[model samples]
Target: MLKLIVNNLKERKIGLHELNSEELTEALHYAVANQDFALQREIGNHFTHIYDQTDEIPYWFKSEYDDDVTIINFGQRDKVVDWSSVTLEDCLPLTHSKHKPLLNGFKNWLLAVSDPLENGGAVIKTSTVKMRVEKVLSLIDAILLRSAALQLSLYHLSHITCDFWLSLFKAMSENGPINGVYDFTGRTVELVKAHVKSITQEQVNAFASKYPFVIRDIAEDDLTLHLAKQERVKACCWLYSQGYYKYGSSFIATGNGAVLAILLFEGKIASPSLNTPTSTELWLTEKERSTEYRPFNTENSKTSTAEATINTYISMAKLINTNIFKDNASSPSIEATKALSVRKINDLVILKPAGRTQTLHPDVVFKLTRQSFEFVLKFQQDILDA
Candidate 1:
């Protein structure tokens, strides 16, 4: 486990040699400025250890480091300096940069959770288990660091919930393919798609081997209202079994033929709401009652329904992004939503959202939301403005 962590640190260019006395001094000042006594102690120990060493120091450290005894001894010596009164500006070059602070915070959190000494050495016993936990922590730390560097808010990071991580592990362990779509809520479909693409099969397998769990496969069905309704119910039930029941959304990544379904929970509920059927549902129902399978099975109706469903999802995606970001006082330019269009080529329904295109097979049923219909009414006005 120790070796694995060391290797990962090496890969990230965060080796022990990278932690110079100067950087450790800066960390100490930052901790002292924040009045974080615990962090101050940790940084102080590192700073004192590095400064006391007679051996060669890291390249980033200054050659005349012996001259600045006052800065180095700020937190190390017995001299009483008021931590609470110290402002950030007083720290000067000792302060961490924008993303570094968040990265440091995440690293601290990871260490706290995984450190056996802090947990009374009760959480982890075996080296194998420890290595697995560390791997997950490293993956999360990397994601958080990237998000911080990109200037994404804590709210955006919050969306990568514990459930999402658990589901990822489940997907890895389960040999059968998981059929689901990405949640398009909060205009995060593009971000989620990028993340999905970045994930390697090897990582999934490794996570799965570490923690094995079963995830039931969702079978593919023809694109129809009846099928969509049935699949939605099945999906909700599966999620409920996994202790997730609240909000649900799906998005498809046409490039990789990947579908991700995300389920979120808030408060407990006796039952989830089942709203009225859509026009496609009505058409399916009418066809079922007429005993005329040929009319309902016609290529024209299949193409039309498929196109309608894709359009509905695209509109909903736009509205969701608009409302979420607007509330947060940020406007996200969603080029994918703006470029969304659907066309029928012969019996097939082709959806082009941004540059990526997806063909809706007759065997797949696309899910739709109430917001999709509501937004479609003003589609023309919205498109012209965009």
Candidate 2:
């Protein structure tokens, strides 16, 4: 078994070599988070022992597999199936067989109750069984890790926008010494790609093998969060240009890797060029706007086009820069409601709001208190005028 384990690891070693540095971190999360296999055996064994004495078979007490049904002297008999390639249904020729699966179950129950204790009823020892538990746990971890690797299901990045993600990547990707989220001295896409290269799978596998229970499966929650962010990205594209002007750049790369600001198309053009040493803005046209968009990392649902997604972003920028930023405090209630909606719209995060529902469009919705709704509008106006 040890040789088998070692060989499995060896064969996978080459495949893991291709993991980027960040991908490796997520992979490690999968590898390290699960319960030991010993626990499963202990739990399974306990069930067996309990059934041995009860004699009264619980309705829930079902064997791993099923056998055929029977009709015998006891009204209806059941045939119990042991480990075999043939299923219980196939084992007994229904035309001739008088017994069914129920009979086997009844018999087992009778056996259990007839002798709750065996020859003075001593406890069974299981220390030897534990020796291989760690190995089994490790093997299970590997199986899960491989599954995740094959499917790309273990991305654990925070629920931030891609613009922010890009910025962080830029900071971490640079050459030379790095420190935390700040690495301004280095710049360029190549630097970020290098950091991405740092991610791998084996590191995740080793860590996941340690905890075999709790973190057993890839987190579907994270995927939902990502999908929500994707929706936001799409919104930024489709909203009022996301506040852009002049050169028409769609996003802003900034903060020495600490932050990435996605410059959406602003509704109105600033007096000067969109980007100067101090300012950068993105631009968009009317066709790029969106009403309501879906969330990201979709495990369930139809796929949306990237172009459609971009439209929302553009609309957001234009709306903010024009109506919201440019001194338009027309609907303080509406603006606050928009932000509240943006922050938690059809996303993974479960946000339960108090009060009434504000329906901006057929696709967009908002749940907010009256006061909070007003505050959002005022805040949006401030951004526009600022």
Local distance difference test values of all predictions, in order: 0.32, 0.28
TM-score for candidate 2 = 0.13
- Residue-pair clashes per candidate: 10, 96
User: Which residue runs does candidate 2 get wrong by more than 4 Å?
Assistant: 1-196, 209-222, 225-355, 358-386
The residue-by-residue lDDT of candidate 2 on 1-386, one tens digit each, is 33333234346643334545664444444334544344333333344564254344333224421333211111233322221211122233312233232223222322222232321343323331122222222221222222222221221111123343223222222221121122221222222323333334453344335322212232454332122222222322322232322224434321111112122111111111112221111112222326474333223222222322222332222221122221211111223323322233324222223444332443333433566678878798787788
lDDT of 2: 0.28
What clash pairs does model 1 have?
Answer: 180-259, 180-260, 181-251, 181-259, 181-260, 182-251, 182-260, 221-363, 222-363, 223-364
Instruction: Please write out the lDDT profile of model 1 over residues 280-381, one tens digit for every residue.
Output: 211211223454434333233222223344443333323323222323232234442354344322123332234423454445433334556667775968
Query: Best by lDDT, which number?
Result: 1
After superposing all C-alphas onto the true structure, candidate 1 shows an RMSD in angstroms of 26.1
- What's the CA RMSD of model 2 in angstroms? 31.4
Each prediction's TM-score versus the true structure: 0.19, 0.13
